[model samples]
Target: MDALGIAVIVAVLVVATTIGLWHRRTDGMIRDEAADKKRRAAILAAAGVETVEFPDRKSSNAVASAAAKAASGAAAAAVHGNDTVRAANAAARSAAAGVPAAPDLPADSGIAVPVDSGVPAPAGPVDEAASAEPAGADPQLAEPGVPGVREPGDVAAERKSGVVPDSREEPGVVEAAARDASAAGESLDQGLLDRLGIGPAQATLLQFSSAFCAPCRAVRRISGEVAELLPGVQHVEVDAESHLAEVRELNIWRTPTLLILDAGGQVVKRATGVPSKPQLIAALGDVLPDA
Candidate 1:
């Protein structure tokens, strides 16, 4: 072959090789993202935060974190932090308004679990060490407090005319304060929370499903009935297909998983497969109490 022709062929080969590598990298990225989401879901579920609507928390926290960093002068325009932050804020607003898609997870370098054709429970019982009942005592204040629950009537009389409970002012103290606040603004989110069916007060019957969960209507009905059987409990349904976040948040790899929490928002029980009403009721009453 002529020298120029040989050179041209070599250049074409190099370009093709580069394109192939890029395609492979892109595919790997996609796979990794999916795996991370699954892992994240499992992690969240394990933490007993199943009903908090992760996408909202994630978006809200991202915005708050960004604002804090910017306020501290840690963001860089050259790094496009401003643009990214702006985009996240806009996305957050859209997500709140149901006007946009949920944000995607950043691609990761770790592998996720095996192919889940069926909703499989974890291999064994809750890891004894992690699930240990804090030496016969439940952890103190692990569950989030339920509003309109045991509220002191004087809480309303002490309210200001227009002041909202600022998570600032006291700053970084709201989580604990928000959990224990007896003030007016601090206790009103219960209706919103009750609608979501999550609180430490009792089992809200988030869901009762099974593996290969497709048509989740039946599962919802069954779960609802069981939840009703228990007073002060709210039942909510999340189909495995539609709300993977809830599954991941509550480590619900198995359908028919039950998440039992105390009023402090801590996960005290995780039951996979169908559990009887008595079994579930007993779990609701179970806690470490002082751990």
Candidate 2:
């Protein structure tokens, strides 16, 4: 053979060997599903659970319903609390500056009267001072430097600005970074569970597999064993070919991707390939019932 042909053969062999080594090195290891925070956040957001908590609160409802209710309740409460804080701050600013704060108009009286309307405008300013509480009425909204009022740079303004404090940096939030990332977002709903012939449990071993993948059967066996051994846990196997939409939406790139979901159907961890029973149990520690 010509030297050029031999060199071409050598190059092909080298590339093939390199690819094989890379795949073998990572075949069955449990690792973070997404490569970066942004990707992980995107996955969670796509799953309709951007801020649901982990195994801390278990649920038997379908993953979607539980996660949606939790996210809705949390958002409503936060918005309500922030609005209250803003109203209080406005009142405090007016009191400190000796300005008359406008009285709240009733909901039904919100229609604006046109300038040429026959209705007559009020002749004088409202006597807010007569009906409203005096300055420093609520100790919590008193001016800065008071005994209990928050200073100028407190988190009240941060909350008002819609700046969410980093969940990881928040007090009492430390854990293995990978585990924490897994816990952040990604949930499945009840309807999907029903369609897949699975029911809700405290924790779910959700396996995505295809017909031709030999290792997928092993993963199924391991997941089933884990589910049987662990109370409140269920094993659910899905044929990736049959559920192409879910497979694509979830970014399931491999034949045997297993999603470890908490009781509320929030995905707390994910792994691809066949996993040892011990490793599966360890991955489930966060959602497992307390012994």
Candidate 3:
């Protein structure tokens, strides 16, 4: 039609469309907020920290009736000096049944609520140390020198079962243990070689040692260091636990002995006592001529 008439119609249509969309958005937002509030109310009721009353799980219409009761009870408690009649009744039932009160919620002082079953107080006060810890702080949480306890998950029950029966492992026991482990099977033959993951295809440098024997450490340290530098060499540290068995079998007498074997698993060079770094390199050089 006319230009002014067209402009007026378009303006009216735009205003109507904007109003409709605005109302729709407002309604959606209101609905979303109500749903969120209901969800939060439900969560609070589940946690038992809500000001409103909700029936316990066993009750019929527990969730709905409980939510309504909780909202109403909260309003009532604010007006009625926090009567908490329902809470008191629940607590009373808990006490009579020898159940604990209020889940032992800790206060800001870090002390737990003392368990009571409506019973008389103990003849004496509870010991401060006897308080149960929150799982992780138990001293038995870790075994000494052991990185992770055996039961990887749920260590609580393990703390009770694997509780070190008052017999303490020695200090630096791991280091000493490692040393003793090295001395173990001092005269390891071919079978022990296979057990140690040393095969015919692998070159071997066996370090024989004895526990409580001095100078063996220095020898082991030097040979071990030199063996580390030699790429193809596999250092097998054997302990001299007893001379009567494998040592007698292997006809070995000296301690901190080094036996260099070629890739074919044949013994090529022998050093009695801890070999010097040069001696270690020379022994390996015989097995690995190029090195």
Model number with the top TM-score: 2
How many Å off is the CA of 266 in candidate 1?
A: 2.8
Give the per-residue lDDT of model 3 (tens digit) for 211-283.
8768678876776687688776677777766433655544457776666655433344556654557756764
Candidate 2 structure, TM-score to reference: 0.51
Writing each residue's lDDT as its tens digit, candidate 2 over 203-245 gives 7888999989999989989998888888878898899999987
| lDDT ranking, high to low | 2, 3, 1
RMSD of 2: 18.8
In Å, residue 182's CA in model 1 sits off its true spot by 24
Runs off by more than 4 Å, candidate 1:
1-132, 135-201, 208-222, 287-291
Question: Which stretch of 10 consecutive residues in model 1 shows the poorest summed lDDT?
Answer: 108-117
| lDDT, each prediction | 0.35, 0.49, 0.38
lDDT, model 1 = 0.35
TM-score of each: 0.32, 0.51, 0.32
Report lDDT (Cα) of residue 98, candidate 3.
Answer: 36
Query: Candidate 1's residue-wise lDDT over 1-291, tens digit each?
Result: 599999999999999999988755542111111123335556887998773422223233233322222211111111111222332233234334442221221111000100111122343422232122221111111112111211233223213211222323333312222222111111113333444456544334556464575434454554567667766666655455555655554455656555444333333345554555555555544321222
The true-versus-predicted C-alpha distance at residue 4 of model 1, in Å, is 60
